[model samples]
Target: MTMKKEYRVKKNTDFQAAFKKGKSFANRQFVVYSLKKPEQKHFRIGLSVSKKLGNAVMRNQIKRYIRQAFLEMENEIQNEYDYIIIARKPVTEMGLQEIKKSLTHVLKLSKVLKA
Candidate 1:
């Protein structure tokens, strides 16, 4: 299943705001930037997978994995934040489970995911 539209950070301005104002955390595979938005009732996420990682197909696959991971972890993540996740080069070599693990690690580091 795909992530719901409301949970996605689609606008460039939203992404820029997160990057400039959020606190960030990183692991080997991903970087997560989180900005608290108390006015928001649910968390929103933005993803970035650089073209340098691979072809369009590969990047799309990585994004799919990330969205699935978040879907699974929805209850564990805080709802009042905007998160921007950037895939690092190493993510090009990972499968869904590995991607989930890496994403979890970064989210935990950012304190957006409950331990």
Candidate 2:
């Protein structure tokens, strides 16, 4: 299943806002930038997988894994923020479960994921 459009952060301005004003947290595989948006009723996420990581297929795979992770963890994640997730080189060596673990670590560091 795909994430709903309301849960995606699609605009360049939105990504930039998160980068500029949000608090950031990082682990070996990912960087998470989170900005609280009290007016928003649900969380929204933007993903960044650089070309340096891989070609289109690999990048898309990484994105799919991330979206899936978020979908699975939706109930545990806070719903009043905007999040920008940036993939790191190390993520290229990981599988879906590893990716989810790494992402969960970063989100925890940011205190956005409930214990």
Candidate 3:
């Protein structure tokens, strides 16, 4: 049997602890939040494609595309941060390059690129 990897931002009590815990940023297409983990040696990410984007098909398509975009960026991100990508409504009209570009831009904003 095989198990899938788990990559979700956990619950924390302090919002300040959370914000100081990580940096976040948003653009027209998406919002990204990231935190540095003391124990993790590799980076893991979660994607949030909200209902506001569209129906199931549109949401899933964006999720898949973003996941792929993240995969392409795995080498560039810091291993200590657990990344979360939240999709905005505008993302539905964008292509993979736009998605990838957004992901890269947000990472830079979140300091994940520096991480």
Candidate 4:
């Protein structure tokens, strides 16, 4: 399933807010920053894959994998938080399952997944 637009963290201001105030959780493949906003009804997710990691195609591939993983785990995720997933160098070589595992680990560390 595709992630809905409203569930995406699309603005620079939102990214800045999350970055400035969010708590972080990291693994070998990803670093996730989370900011809880209890007033919102759903989670908002942002992804960052830098040019330093790879070329455009490689970056987009990682993003697709992340989105798919997030989509699969959306129901288990806690509501009202903004999540930013930053890809690490190792992430470029990882497959979807590995990415999912890393994402899950970070989410749990940040307490953004429902118990």
TM-score of each prediction: 0.96, 0.97, 0.81, 0.96
Off by over 4 Å in 1: none
Kindly list the per-residue Cα lDDT of model 4 for residues 39-64, writing each as its tens digit.
99999899999999989999999999
Q: Report the number of the highest-TM-score candidate.
A: 2
Error of 3 at 100 (Å): 0.1
| Whole-model lDDT per candidate | 0.92, 0.94, 0.76, 0.91
lDDT by residue (1-115, candidate 3, tens digit) is 2112654443443224445666789888888777777798787676778898899999999988887887777788888877777899889999999999988987787777845
The candidate that wins on lDDT is: 2
Error of 4 at 39 (Å): 1.2
Whole-model alpha-carbon lDDT for candidate 1: 0.92
- How do the candidates rank by lDDT, highest first? 2, 1, 4, 3
Itemize residue pairs with steric clashes in candidate 4: none
Q: Better model by lDDT, 2 or 3?
A: 2
Candidate 4 Cα RMSD (Å): 0.8
Name model 3 segments beyond 4 Å from true. 1-4, 7-21
Is 2 or 4 the stronger prediction by TM-score?
2
lDDT of 1 by residue, 20-101 (tens): 9999999889989999999999999999999999999999999999999999899999999999999999998899899888
Task: Report the Cα lDDT for candidate 2.
Answer: 0.94
- Give each model's clash number: 0, 0, 0, 0
Worst 10 residues of 4 by lDDT: 104-113
Cα lDDT of model 2 by residue, 24-46, tens digit: 99988999999999999999999
